[model samples]
Each structure stands twice: as structure tokens, then as C-alpha cells.
Target: MLPRARPTRVVRMPDTSRLDGMTSTVTTPSSESVPRSHPADRTGAQVAADAAAVIGSADLSEAGLRRFLHGLPGVDRVGADGRAAHLGTRSIKTTAKAWALDLTISMVDLTTLEGADTPGKVRSLVAKARTPEPGDPTCPRPAAVCVYGDMVAEARDAVGNSGIRVAAVATAFPSGRAGRQVRLADTRDAVAAGADEIDMVIDRGAFLSGGFRKVYDDIVAVREVCHDAEHPAHLKVILETGELATYDNVRRASWLAMLAGADFIKTSTGKVSPAATLPVTVIMLEAVRDFLATTGVQVGVKPAGGIRTAKDAIKYLVSVNEVAGEPWLDPDYFRFGASSLLNDVLLQRQKLATGAYSGPDYVTID
Candidate 1:
């Protein structure tokens, strides 16, 4: 049977009681306190410059990571998880269902990151992203195609002028254990090969050991390199929140990425266990929303891995609208990282329109 869409409600901020046992004070800069980016014609250098100004004369030493993290307002575990569960219960129906399905398709990153990935595979993925459904020209294309750095050129070449962006996962992806120099070089190669966005993993070891300075510096260095690239790719910092092990860590990592000038903060590498859960995404969304409120600079968010259904995607949109507001509903600010998700969304769209379930033969398998 087809899954029925349920009614969705506007999620209001939880009560203050939810704040109990959470961090009460945050030392992060407010909108008036932080230096604002140039509103017009901004570039990569401007991002780095604004970040430097934001980090001026602060205690980012090893000992200060905890203090800095604790200084931020704490997250209420129950409140966040409750919000996610509640939002997931929403059933989008009829025209709302159709709208959400299309919006979800638009927000997808259409990822394919496997050790065995090849040029032919990437080209096919690009074709799937562009046409989606061969007979349905009404179907919109996905936002971008995500692949490993090595396959970037192949993907880019195939996606040429289709209005589709090509994103590359770099910096020794999934496990970011490479040295800073190697990671920067990795980013440069991808950009030179025409990657519009670069997804880099952070050294989870550093973050777990309170080496926050190391983590922050690495993101800054990569951001600088991305800006300096001739094509100027946007940087997406993957925190691998499942490894972080707590909402507090997720919130801290989100802020750390934003403070380091990450164009987007991602949930996971999709190569790890427990990739992209609702609670983790919720905390990240809150971080971006709060960052925008405080710095007047908006950074995007991508929740990669484990989100497979059209229902799951729309629930994320509902969260984005409710937690981050309507501004983040656009493809520029939000994206999904998945390979099979496109087919599932296509299947769901067909089911909604025809009053019947779609078999695998009906959609493209990339």
C-alpha cells in the first residue's frame, strides 16, 4: 500500500522547562557584535576575511574548546528529539504532497560515492539527475550530483550546461585523517576539475579529543584554498555527528563549522553508521538558524545519508520551514545527499498522480 500523507503543524519553540539542565549562557557573537559580510558581490576572500574578523582575539586554545562550547546555550535532548518525532508524523496530502515531492526532488544532491564508482557510472548518474524521468518533462531536475573527487571531471562534463551543479567529496572523505596539506591539495584538484562545491570531512579524532583549535584551523585552511581556487568552490564541512555521540557535540560542531566560514555544514559522510538522523539534523538546523540570527550571515545545511523515502525528505523540509524559516526552503540553502532517493521520490510522485504504486521498471536506476 502507498504511504498516506498526514497533516503537518507549525512547530513552535519548546517551553522554557525544556531548557532545564541545558547550558544557559553562550559567548558567541550577536548580529551587532559580529562583522557582517559585504551584501553585494561577495566572494571567497570576503568569506575568509569575515571569518577572521569573527575569530579576533578569542581564546581558541586547546583548553578553551570546552569553555567555548559550554558558553553556547545548551540543547534540550527531549525537546529536540520530541520536535523531530512530532515533525515526522506530519502527513502532506494532495496538492501539498505534490508540492513537497517536487520540492524534495529539487533539494536533492543526488549522490554516488562508492569505491567502485567509475566515469560511466557518474555519467549515468548525471543523466539521471538531469532528466530524472524520461517521459515526464514536467519533472524537475535535482540540485546537484555528488561524487568522489576523482570522478568530478567526468560528472562535470556530463552535466555540462544542464543547469546542474557538480559537487565533489574531498579531503580523504568518510574518514578525514589526512594531513592538512594533503586535504588542501585534494580540494584544489577537485575545484580545478570543475567541482562547484567541495564536501570535506573534519578530523573527528581532533574534535573528540577537544582539539577544537585543530578542527577550526583545518576548516579555515580548506575554506581559504577553496576561495583561492580559480573556480571558487563552496566548502561543506562534514561533522559525522554520529561519532560526536551527543546533541551537545553536534551543536558545538555546527557552530564551529559556521564560525570557520563553512558554506554548508553536513551531517555525515554516509560511509559511517547512523548517518543523518533526525535529532542530529534538528540540532544542526538550530545552529544555522541561530548563527544567522546572531551573525546576519546564512550558511546552508545538507543532511546526507539514511534518508530514503519521499516522506522522509518532506519531513526534513517541514523542519527547515519550522526551525529555520521559509528562507531555507530553497535549493541554494538546503540539500539531500542520496543516490536511490531520486528513484524513490519519482516512484512516489507517480503513485500520487496515477493512484497506483510504481514498479522499479518505471524509473531510471542510476
Candidate 2:
């Protein structure tokens, strides 16, 4: 009887070390909204008492929790441009189904993404990404292009006619440390410019500070604001696993975000170092799997940043295929947040079909 869903607290970097072995606690009665406790404020004794209270009253069954999560509000904005759109048009459904893509965070490490890698540059990169190659068995394009909020419009425009949906990062990306007004405005602006989906960062500092309510409120507000926009942006809450070190903490954040209203739960902004490792993606996808099974809702997963080569993308794909099975293999439920990975994947694909080391551009994929 507990209230359906609750928002999760943000996890800050400075406090991540503290949660290395210990995770925050949520306490709630069976028929009431879950009350989240910030361990940072309460004395050790008080914190332990709250933890015991939560453990005592709440129904911790994953099945029931997942069902409730699946029932949350939000439009399922699956684009027609994914494998569904591409191969369907060609009248060869199997070719489109033959390939799946990673929903990347799309930031390059060699350059300063904010300045040198301006919105225009990002847009250009996106353009190259949407162009299909001659060797493509079905001539199908990638599912989506993910970028910073400022470039969402540019990306949409650049990928025009290619049928790729543009995804924008919001909520003060890389650090969810902005004022509520600022965060809402960012979401509004991104959606206004035609972003189909949003990748938002959670305030890790607040979560670490035991500011669960503050963090939850902020994410919920963004979720609401994102939903209000014309484009009906999909919200992807980034847990910033590098900032949240423990597997338990990652699991907790995954559930909390799912409960809060995340259509997708992604890792890292691709701006932070050590972004998107397999272990973390595994943990998050596991949460996605459980959340889906229990709730009957399908949520997407994006492992952003640090995935540069085809091999890395393949490894991630292999892992997802192994752990989550074929249902989760579609671009709808799986994605990789990479900027430089497409070319390699295409190059490898071409080589596999025709044994020749083609020029970087010969692959016809950017």
C-alpha cells in the first residue's frame, strides 16, 4: 500500500567515498510515501534507527516495486527512425533488426567539449553519424544521436531527412548543481528546440550530503518540466557511477530513478573521467531488467563516455545480449554513449562483409 513511486536523492562526488560500503536508506510505511533519510545529518545511532525502521516497514519485493514503477506516467516516445523505421522503409525488416546501436553521451576527450567542441561541431559530427553507407546490408541508419542541450536543435537539423532523433543532456549536465529554475529552463529550452529525449544529471552532492529530499524534489521537478514540453522529451537520469562508487549504491540509484520517473537510466555524462565501464553498465542494466520484469515497463539504458572503438562497443553489446537477453537488445532498451565508435563499428562491419581494410571514409559511416 505504500505510495506508488518515490524520487531518489542525488549522490555527490565528495561523499561517494563514504557510500563505498554503505548506502543511503529509505524508510516508509506499507501504505505511505517512502520517507528517505539522509545519513549525513543524523547521528550514527539515529541513522541506524531510521535504517531499521525502513527495513521493518517497507515491502522490498522487486516484483511489486517493478509493477508500480511500470505504471508511472510518461509517453513512450520510441522513434520510427530506429531499426524499426530504417529497415521497415527498405522492406527488409531483418537487416534493420540485424543491427542495434549504443545511445552514446557523444563527447570527445581530445578537445574541450564546451568551447572548442562547439554546438556546430557537435552538429557536424551528428550529421556524419546519420549518413548511411553503401555496404550497409540494409542501408539502415543509427537509432539516435545524443548531444549537449545547446546542440539538440543543431543536431536535429543536421540529421534531418535521416530520421534520427536528437537527444540532449540537461539538468546542469556532468553536475546537477544548478538551481531548480535553471534546471527547468534548461529542460524547457532543449525540448523547445526539438530534442526527442533528455539525459539529465542528478545532484550527487546533495545525495552525498544526505539531501535526499532536495535531490528527489529536483529530479521530480525536472521530470515534470520535461514532460510539459511540446516534444515530450524522454528523461534519462544519469547516476554518474564514477561519482557513486559502490554497486549497491548504483543499484539503489537505479531503482530510485526508476521510481522517480526516469524513462531511461544512463551512466556518466561522458564528461567525467572513467565514464561508462562495463561493470557499472552491467549493474545498471541489471536494475533495468528487474525493473522491467516486475513492472512490465521497458526502460532504455545508455552507457555514455569512454567507449571509442568498435571492440568496446561490441563488448558492451555482447554483455547486454548475455545479461539482458534479446528483448533488451533493441535500440529502444539499449544504447552506448560514444562519439567516436560509429566509424569503427561501420569499418568493422564492412570488413566483415568484404575482406579489405577500407579507408576511414570508405566505410561510408561517420
Candidate 3:
């Protein structure tokens, strides 16, 4: 039987009592009260101009690594897993557009969303989700249709009975430049309108501008808005790794986000030039691993944007399995925030199962 769609509800913030034992305190970012250890605090437009002055400038030795790693609740370094050789076969077979997608593409003004060629582009994307043409063999079904605040109800209505999730980018998406009350209100509104998961963009600007405290406080406030029991929408925090730059910086962002109550730590906003890449994902996964060990809180990791093939997804899977150990392999712990790449994964799955390559409709993710 197909999994029944979990109904969306009005999400309430976690109780203050639950906050008693948590490791880190979420703080608002400012010049005076910056977050404790996130290196993203060092990146900004002006700083990027001084790349030559920044490259390999900071100490990244083993001691530096241990200092950051040991701060998390449950972090420990594993020598090497003998299962490292199993990194190659990471593909999932399905059609690209038919499966699911987290339409949380916040890098641009989605209100001016391009490619809405048909009358109901969002509806069409929802309707055509289960159908495919003969010639389109490489596409895979998107996991969900992600959208921002206002469209949650529309997306929910469009995807009715399809058993697909309608995710909304919330907590002041993209820029996350809103005030705390506004951000929390946005999250509450999205959930009430039937959004399944909340994809939040971290305040990269604040984190990069020596305002980690603000960034942390923002995430906690947003998280509070969505922590209800019945309609519990998971939170995915986008780090905008491209803007942050450097593997070490990515690692620090991951730790900070995970510590700040993010259920999943994601890579980019798709608007940024660098987007999601290999090294950034590696760092994020390792951060998740260490955080899980320390705090015993197993958060998820998502690599969004710029992924387009089965091979790419497989590499990410390999990286997760390699760096994070075997326990983090499930979709609950890992997700791909992609729209263009699911088809290639499906095509490859078709070839592996059937001797001959087939068209898009040949496979179904359900």
C-alpha cells in the first residue's frame, strides 16, 4: 500500500522545558553578540574581494579541527571505514519529474518564476508528476513540490491524492532578512496551509558578517514555530555554501546550523554561483556525524542545486556513507534538493534493471 499523506497542522514551538538539556543556545546575530564558532562569520562580498589574503590564511591543522569537532555534543573521529570501497553504486532508478522535488528554490524571486509556460505550471507540475512521455526516458519523479509562503495551499490542493509532499520555504526564505516575529509568523502560516516540511534559508549574511548570534536566534525562533506534535514539519536549513566559501567554513556552518535546532543542514540556494559541490557536502556530512555523536541528535543532510545526474547523486550518497558511517544512509537522514537530476537517476535505474534503456514512463518511484 502507498504511504498515506501525513496531514499538515498548525505547528507550535517546542516547550521551554525541552530546551533545558540542549547543548547550544540560539542567539541573535549582531556586531556585539556574534555566534560562537561558525566560520561563515568571516565571509561577505567585501571579504570575497580579498580572496588572496584569505586563502589558507587561518590555521586548519588537526588541533583546529579537534577544537571545533569536540565542541559538539557527540563528535569523534573514525579512522576509516573498511566499507569505503562501496562508494560507487549510489544511483536510484526513477523518472526525474515524476518522483519528488523540494521546490524550495529561493535563490531567485520565485514570484517571478520563469518556465511557467502552461496555464497551471504548478498544477501541471503536480498533475504530470505521475505521467511521462515516451521520449523522455531520463527523468525521475520529484519527491515533492516546494514553494514559498502563499502557495502552500495552492500546492497542497494541486497535489491532492497524489501522496506527494507540499513543502514550503519558510522562516523568511532566501534572504531570511525579516524580523523574528515575522519569520515565525511566516512559518506558522505555511504549516497551517498544509506545508509538509519547512525549508529555511539560514541568515548567511548575518553569519558571514560576524553576527552568528543573530543567525542562531533566527533559526531557533523559526524552529519553534514548527515543532508541533501532529503536524510536525521537518526543518531543512540552507547554508548557501557558495557564498560562504572554503570547506572549513562549510564545516563550521554545518555545526552551527545543526546545533541551532535544524533537523537537516542543506548546501545552497541555487541562486549562488558555486551552488552545491562535492567538498561542501563532505564537510556537512562530517559535521552531522560529529554532532550526532556529541548531542545524540541525528539530524539530516541535504545537498541542493547543481546536481543533475545519477552519478552525481551516487557520489553524494557515497560521500554520506563514507564520511558519516552506515547509519546515515536512509532518506530521512539524507535528501537531494534537486529538480533537474532525478530523471538521470531513473534512466540509470531502468538500464540496470532492464537490459535495454527505456523511456521516462518505464519506471515509477511509487
Question: What are the models' TM-scores?
Answer: 0.87, 0.69, 0.65
lDDT of 1 by residue, 238-280 (tens): 9998899888889889878887778899999998889998878
Residue 364 of model 3 has an lDDT of: 38
**TM-score (C-alpha, index-matched) for candidate 3:** 0.65
Q: Between prediction 1 and prediction 2, which has the larger lDDT? A: 1
- Model 1 root mean square deviation, Cα atoms: 9.6
Order the candidate numbers by TM-score, best to worst.
1, 2, 3
Task: In angstroms, give how far residue 42 of model 1 lies from its true place.
Answer: 5.8
Which residue ranges in model 2 land beyond 4 Å of their true spot? 1-113, 134-137, 359-366
> Which 10 successive residues of model 2 have the least lDDT summed?
22-31
lDDT of predicted model 2: 0.58
Cα shift from native, residue 296, model 3 (Å): 1.1
State the TM-score for model 2: 0.69
The top-ranked prediction according to lDDT is 1
Candidate 2 lDDT tens digits, 15-126:
1222221111211112122232311223323322322222222333444333333333221123211322222233212233235322221221111135455766766666
